[model samples]
Target: MKEGPNIAAIAALIGDPARANMLQALMTGVALTASELAQEAGVTPQTSSFHLSRMADAGLVSLRKQGRHKYYSLADADVAALLEAMSGIAMRSGMTRVRTGPREPELRKARVCYNHLAGEYGVQAYDSLIAREFLVEEDEKLVLSSSGRSFFTDLGLVLPSNETKRRPLCKSCLDWSARRSHLAGITGTALLSFFFDQGWAKRVEGSRVIQFSKAGDSRFHEAFSLQN
Candidate 1:
């Protein structure tokens, strides 16, 4: 690599299967300890720490110490976005491994992508919002309309006054499983939190799945008019 940004370095780091697994696990937006990551990577704790150290040095992962244990998470939403994009390309290109996991179906139905909702329900919500004029696309960017503000407020989600201005109010993230766009950014994060607060869904332990109860699922579909 010359004196420029080197994607090859990042690619090489993520190319290892164990490291890839660790990164995928972090896509759930949960900080995991070295031992927990080792279990996900099918590696020993020492090896997990070694791999984690390299990724952290490369800005692929970030670590925080809680008590005596250090928990690791993706460095940022950009890293998670990159991995999600890669997964889409791999699936579209037929480069996927055979025999998806038992949880794969649930994941495809609904899951968390970093700090936002993803999969079928997420896609539906994004589409519905656009159709209802809650959001608009302009100049390759998602813009939350004035109606969107009212809609979200009615749902009991008020935009924080001190929310970081660096992040957009609305953004689109490509869903890996659905191969479609899902809402992201500050608004997306707020909506997902709203779902939890409304008791519409809960995160599955040790996984990325967001399981909605029967009534919750019905309410979700009705609220979003996703009965297509």
Candidate 2:
């Protein structure tokens, strides 16, 4: 008998089409109701409920109660990271679903990955940081340098000090759509929130896309230009 965590069981739970769709929907970092998820998954409400129950039981999702309604979201950042990595693998392996819509280009340009920015713009931001020497790659590990700390502070993104934790302060999250690496971890989430707070980007309703205005696009490039 295998003497470690069971990957097969978890994979089985995510292997179902309906469940996969529901999980993907939750990847938008938004809590959704069963009915909303059913619509997203193209499944009946009863079927969606069954799948959600299984996912919750397996720890893939969590339930939140609000009055008479229940909302579901990915259990935590780890689950979102797993899905993002799997998506990168699937895209590289030529496993894709048939998809087409007006929002396709926008999604390819900018979208949310778990809680942080992703897609072309996300990759660009990461590259700019690297080019500017704000982040350093040491032994395949991403680390924030002294200058990076000061830079973030200047941007009003002062990271909370946590000495007891072992998690990396800055990590690379593979960008499935762009086939590159984007920033992840606590700093990444903070940067995304900054964009929202500054009104530079907005989440598209009922989707994972992050829509940046024309002015926002120009300003973003100015702020994180690779040439700098």
Candidate 3:
């Protein structure tokens, strides 16, 4: 018997089509009820509950209770990162869905991967940070430079002290659509929060899409020094 981790078991759990749909829907970083997940997965609520129970037991998802209602989300950033990486592999392998919808274009433009920005705009932001030397690669890991600290502080982004946190301050996530790395980890979350707080972008209802208004779009490009 193999002595390492049982990846096959986890893969089997995620291999189901209905559960995959439910999991993808939660990638928006939104907690969802079983009924909502049922709608997303095209399954009955009872079936959704069963799937949710299995996922919960496997630590792939976390559940929250609000009064009499229960909501579920991906367990943590790790799960989201895994899903995103899998998506990129599927895309590269041409395992795409047959039907493309209008939302496809919007999703490719800008969307949320868990709590951080992803897609084309996300790649642009990461590139800008690298180009401006706000972030640097050291020991094969993304590190926030001293200039990055000052840059973020000047932008009113309150960064968490590294000594107090278990998560890295800077990390890179591979964007599925753009096929490039984007910012992730603590700094990435802070940056996305800053955008929301400043009203530079907003999440689209019932989707992962992060829509930037015209003025907000301009501001984001100007701030990141992205080409028009």
Order by TM-score, highest first = 3, 1, 2
Best-fitting candidate, scored by TM-score: 3
Residue 65 Cα positional deviation in candidate 2, in Å, after optimal superposition: 0.9
lDDT (tens digit, per residue) of candidate 2 on 111-155: 999889999999999999999889999998888889988988987
By lDDT, the better pick of 1 and 2 is 1
TM-score of 1: 0.95
- lDDT at position 103, candidate 3: 96
Residue 182: error of model 2 in Å? 0.7
After the best TM-score superposition of candidate 3, give how far the Cα of residue 162 lies from its true spot, in angstroms.
Answer: 1.9
Q: Over 4 Å off in model 3, which ranges?
A: 163-166, 226-228
Residue 213 shift from truth in candidate 2, angstroms: 1.3
The segments of candidate 1 whose C-alpha lies over 4 angstroms from its true place after superposition are: 1-3, 161-166, 226-228
Best candidate, lDDT: 3
Q: List, residue by residue over 1-228, the lDDT tens digit for candidate 3.
A: 669998999999999999999999999999999999999999999999999999999999999999999999999988999999999999999999999788999999999999999999999999999998899998898888888889889878989777324478888999999899999999999899899999989999999999998888998888788543
Per-model TM-score, in order, reads: 0.95, 0.94, 0.96
Instruction: Output the lDDT of residue 59, model 3.
Output: 91
TM-score of 2: 0.94
lDDT of 1 by residue, 80-131 (tens): 8899999999999998878888999999999999999999999999999998
For candidate 1, the lDDT comes to 0.92
